[model samples]
Target: MSTTDVSTNDIVGAPVATTVEDVLSRFSGGNREDLIPILQAVQNSTGHLSRESVLAVARHLNLPPSKVYGVATFYNQFRFQPLGKYHIQVCRGTACHVKGSAAVLESLKRILKVEEGQTTKDKLFSLEVVACIGACGLAPVISINGEFHAGVAPDRVAGILNVYRRRAKNG
Candidate 1:
């Protein structure tokens, strides 16, 4: 696994949540204007924004939790839950849409039994739909932790998921 993959930190405990406090310290005395950067840093450190961390951030910034949530939810860049071991990003950009990526996305959702932006109960996978993956020529694409699967059709999603499932099982 790459060292920089934040998904490696998909740990459940106070330890992971505590990193938010460390990130908040960097923005000590900062105000609401610092909310975005603070959130980004926290997510970078903890891999997501948990309710505990969000409350801490609210306290640190002297703002309401609702305000912090408002900003985080407003932007697509923020994630409120830890990424699963496999982070699946489906492209829904113009080119991807034209190529029927939406069907591929729905296939994944149905098979995974989780909606977009959620991790599976096993914590093995999480789904995200991004505006673009920058592989326009490879429209209808999905990537697992930055490894692209190009020209994906709805039927292929299960096979792709099985590949990862087998890997996890074998290891």
Candidate 2:
């Protein structure tokens, strides 16, 4: 949502196997407004949008690659990089901030040994900060793979990380 442009490094490179032809075939080649659906389908197929997929879309939709990339970059929900198996989203909203969310963020960053928007070396977890999760009443919340942990303190972070680590180890 910032005016600053996201760098290509923000999007890890991975080849996309699913083509626009495949998407069009599935949709029966109706309207061009189907571009969004086409892109989403490619993303769902590849787990992330690879450079090849972008080019394929450009060719199929008769748009330039730059425009396609522009649209992809405009949306926050679309991920260019391959996400970790476990995605961790930490709330840093106003209410959370008032309740010491910074401490929780620091704890998570330390435990994961990765800065915000980076995935761990093991590819087990990716850390990200969200404005709010509407759990402000609980404040200082952390969501691991969509499961919310509220009222989290620095002390509790290690245990939570340990739980994920153990699960990873087992699997």
Candidate 3:
């Protein structure tokens, strides 16, 4: 089924019958081993693990909702909230911190009006502060949808965000 056939209410409240059915049909076994893969598949398609989807998975696997939630939460890969079109990852490693990444992060938070790990109200941006991104030489770095912006300064935050905003509007 197409994404258009699925409603936002269904995604957030209860799993759509068609969507859940379609996702379940992909797997063959009811063994516990199927749990991670099933969750991964659902998250892959839906972008995040919604409560409804988790419940549907629990029912399908004859497991408890708590178990599903426990596993999902244990893993860093799973996300409950819907991500914005632009996902921003700010480096907070030692090198980044020493190079003013904190200021850059503050700038992001101020300009986006969202705390770390939160999405903007407009669904245009999501902010995440990571411990490290393996770009020590490029300390004070921020990545927008995986495109690294090295040596980011607080003053440049608006201009950088504007580039993405313009892209969204133009596209």
Candidate 4:
């Protein structure tokens, strides 16, 4: 996958590499209390925390690697793998469920060939099921990289993914 895509939220400096190191340099690098913020920063800067980044953060904080892993796993907010270029978040809240989001979710899984939280092998897409996205009125909504798709039906999943696929290829 091309990391240089214009749609990707890469850091402003056009960091070709050293994303973890670059994010790490922003912190104090020694305080125990700085762990969560450090992890958040890394995730924000790179879409998710990589294993190398987790280890790097542990080393920077002077903590055991297991400690960092434990803290990260304990929270639902942290993800160790980088997200795909197009991250799809399908809302499965009460309203969305009633509106057939389960079928929508299933269609997404089948079409993308990845379960929830898994990225496509090409790194073009990732699937996530969110509890609520504050679009209940537009129940059965899915967000692709924060752009909302409202009133989605299972049949529309392929068209939506095709649009992103075409965008990636054309870019």
Candidate 5:
């Protein structure tokens, strides 16, 4: 066995069973063909493909780190960072853009102190810009974890965020 055969706890720097080692253990062999499936499995369990996890996978499969990272970056489905409790997706399609979604997105960034594709420091929110959410009628819309909010305005960003904050605090 290779040095990569170390325990999952040893590999992840955490005792969790969902580490790269745990995922790799479920598959046999180190064939190059297993790359995508391995990535998908790791991401499915971990919510995101962390840098350490990717490197661990490379070692496990005997592939270069660049090969793994190249494949992961080629796919939009892969995320480098873990998502926040509330994943915020802002629609920036043509209709939403015409309806002033850019201003709405700016407000969200300022209020959350996070740029697109980044989670807030408190881990309460993550922001993403999507081409569309299929809510053209509700232009300038954003969705919090798939729950759509329509007709969002720049000034209303604070009130909208406060609602989620209140719920989290109260709960």
Candidate 6:
């Protein structure tokens, strides 16, 4: 989205994204309690709800910026910035750990050439670590988006990443 679309009133000194007004318009005639939905709308527009977006939301709802920021930060899924298209999460639970999850993690870092929570320079992928995905049966599981990869070997990291690479290219 273009950055020119958002404007800030004198009350709040945050720069809203261009899509904030469209998001606000979705429930223009609704109740003020639609704060959560409003935030979600802003997040969808900008990938993450930025401080500016929250301020715009607060202004729209006639609520406090602190309150809007609090709610946005309280949710783990919400991000205050844009994220890459692909999200890769590796399982780090005991079962996976015993089965060489650390090696898997290391392999991923080497292959992707990025640290955990870091996105590839190309913006094609973002890597992260998860405690567990409850798929202990498949120890050392890795997830690309929501697709599960059980019984992952450090050797297979390249191939797995290649699958996403190919998919990204094809899509």
Q: Which candidate has the top score in lDDT?
A: 1
Report the number of clashing residue pairs per model. Answer: 0, 0, 0, 0, 0, 0
Spell out the clash pairs found in candidate 6: none
* Candidate 4 C-alpha error for residue 86, in Å: 1.2
Quote model 2's TM-score: 0.69
Which scores greater on TM-score, model 1 or model 3?
Answer: 1
Rank by TM-score, highest first: 1, 4, 5, 3, 2, 6
- Residue pairs with colliding backbones in model 1 are none
Worst 10 residues of 5 by lDDT: 6-15
For candidate 2, give the lDDT.
Answer: 0.74
Better of 1 and 2 by TM-score: 1
Per-residue lDDT tens digits of candidate 4, residues 1-171? 222232233322122344878867767547888888777677767777778889999999999999999999887656665688888888899999999999999999998898886889998887877788788999889998778899999999999999999999999
Taking all chains together, each candidate's TM-score versus the true structure is 0.87, 0.69, 0.74, 0.82, 0.77, 0.60
Identify the candidate with maximal TM-score: 1
Tens digit per residue, CA lDDT, model 6, 51-146: 778888888888889988888778654556455567777889999999999999999999889877567888887777778778999999987767
Lowest summed lDDT across 10 adjacent residues in model 6 is found at: 4-13
lDDT of 5 at 76: 60
* lDDT, residue 90, model 2: 84
C-alpha lDDT (0 to 100) for residue 5 of candidate 3: 31
Stretches of candidate 4 above 4 Å error? 1-18
Error in Å for residue 8 of model 3? 27
State the number of backbone clashes in model 6. 0
